[model samples]
Target: MSAVDEIVREWTAQLLDSGSVAALVAGLVALALVLHRATWLPLRGVVTIAHEGGHALVALLSGRTLNGIRLHSDTSGLTVSTGKPTGPGMVLTLFAGYPAVSLLGLGGAWLVTVDLAHVMLWGCVALLAAVLLAVRNVYGVLSVLVTGGAVFAVSWFATPAWQALCGALLCWFLLFGGVRPIAELRRKRSHGRAASSDADQLARLTGVPAGLWLACWFLIALVCLVFGARWLLLMPQL
Candidate 1:
């Protein structure tokens, strides 16, 4: 078999042996529900903050001015004063959101794995401590805990091939499963406005088509999947 086929076979064997496939499905459902609730809480504010920060960071780096920033109970917004970004820049900005966060998480996991086992353990502990210190909200704390657990579990239990499969599955779940509820919530909030004005403005300014932007995001997501799989497969065997 090819390497990809071998990986898939091994993953299936492991899943069947552990009976984790069903459990994983249940866990994903539960996670989706929790994330759906989280969207209704102040935690969404953090996501919004990250999103706007992404925009602000790119704008500043590209020599644009920050016109204003608005934070509301439900959403956060930013206005940058600059001409429309060029095609590539606009695509880069839009694609930066969750992938940036995922990359940060992957980087953190890598750092933990770089040294001894005790060092990795200590790194996880320190990260947990930092989360407790920085976040005041219980929901935020829970989110951090859940995310940390996933990282630790992937690091400790799964082989690299399994990790890659799990990461890809998780990413797919987030993009399709999580996005539906989020879009529903957004539609409710916006009174069924199909097109967001901000997105329209962005498209107009960048002169980049929305479909093209989405295609770029998909490409980046694929790259991330490959990286995630490699990280899992190449992790030190205990």
Candidate 2:
């Protein structure tokens, strides 16, 4: 048989033999729901902390004085300093948060994939453990756990194609989930008379527009999805 014939035959057999199509569809649905919930939940606080902390740490290490730090109830806040940050410094600080959080989650997914083909299954368990541990506020923990559970269940029960679909969906959720709340918080703070000077400073220093930042984050997340799917596909079955 020709190489093309052999390749087509293999694909045809896999498609005919594997009960993955239905599973894949189900997984996609579950992933969609999880992403929707994640976008609405108030998980931006954690992201905010990571973002501002990145700025502060980079600044301190770079020999800049740390003037002040403010965290808000909505998970969007500012880090202030006496000296004006260079363009590069400001850009780094502004863009650091999403990448940090996304990378951490992606790392977690990678670790899970190393141990289990169905990494989302373990992701669910880890999230549940975090909820029990009070790793963050109750709402935050619940949000993570619930979303993780949905993804895990879908991945575990579905076929490989479904798992890939679900992973892609969750990636989108993680990417855009925190943006709306953060933007809303910024707007409210900007107009309020009680807004701190640090808020204004934060607004100024983080000069990258919110829409642009969100787009960049989504792009990074899409890249992560591709990596995650490859990892899933390569994992050995249990």
Candidate 3:
């Protein structure tokens, strides 16, 4: 058989044999990271990647020209794109970050529920690879490389159970991690710090209160967490 055929067959088999781990365990692991400063610090860079990638994805989808992405050392990131600065596209680009993380967590939970955690692990590797091409700084390049390499190793070489655990941890992290930043933003805004945050940007674009935008992001994240937890707590049907 040709290489493509062999690869396809292998993927098909893996898909059929996909596995899942205990949702409680994964959730707890992610919870530790979310609640602890030291543990969360290292992983914050990964969440920042997701946040910036969300902006980049929406920018492209909304017909903007993505310039490059910068992931900073402090777990902050910026995605620059050129387009109309005050239209629906811009609003969408500004609004995509928080929702994107929660939605990804939801997606990961759904994958676990459907016994496709392995698939999502590979999917993350592919995603990180794509993000790597657009990373504009040395730190961003290294971050994506390390993150993608770890996911690739897990997807390609780990046992199905380990893959499921890691996959669940990733998704669970997204779910929990998605919320902390919003709360931080709200606090900063109240203190007049994050005057240029995403919520503030949305307010500027749409003339709504930044607090309102924060509420919306917070609500969406909570809803996603609820749904994800529901999927994870219940035993996988498959």
Instruction: Identify the candidate with maximal TM-score.
Output: 3
Candidate 2 colliding pairs: 24-162
Residue 43 lDDT in candidate 2 = 47
Q: Is candidate 1 or candidate 3 better by TM-score?
A: 3
Give lDDT tens digits, candidate 1, residues 141-183: 5655665676577757876545534443443333333233334
Candidate 1 displacement at residue 165 in angstroms: 20
- Give lDDT per model, in order: 0.46, 0.50, 0.85
Q: Between candidates 1 and 2, name the one with more favorable TM-score.
A: 1
Report the CA-based lDDT of candidate 1 relative to the real structure: 0.46
Clashing pairs in 3: none
Q: Which segments of candidate 1 are over 4 A away from where they belong? A: 1-30, 33-35, 38-41, 82-99, 112-194, 197-199, 222-226, 229-238
Q: What is the lDDT of residue 172 in candidate 2?
A: 34
Q: How close is candidate 1 to the true structure, as a TM-score?
A: 0.45
TM-score of candidate 2 to 2 decimals? 0.44
Off by over 4 Å in 3: 1-21, 235-238
Best by lDDT: 3
TM-score for candidate 3, please give it.
0.89
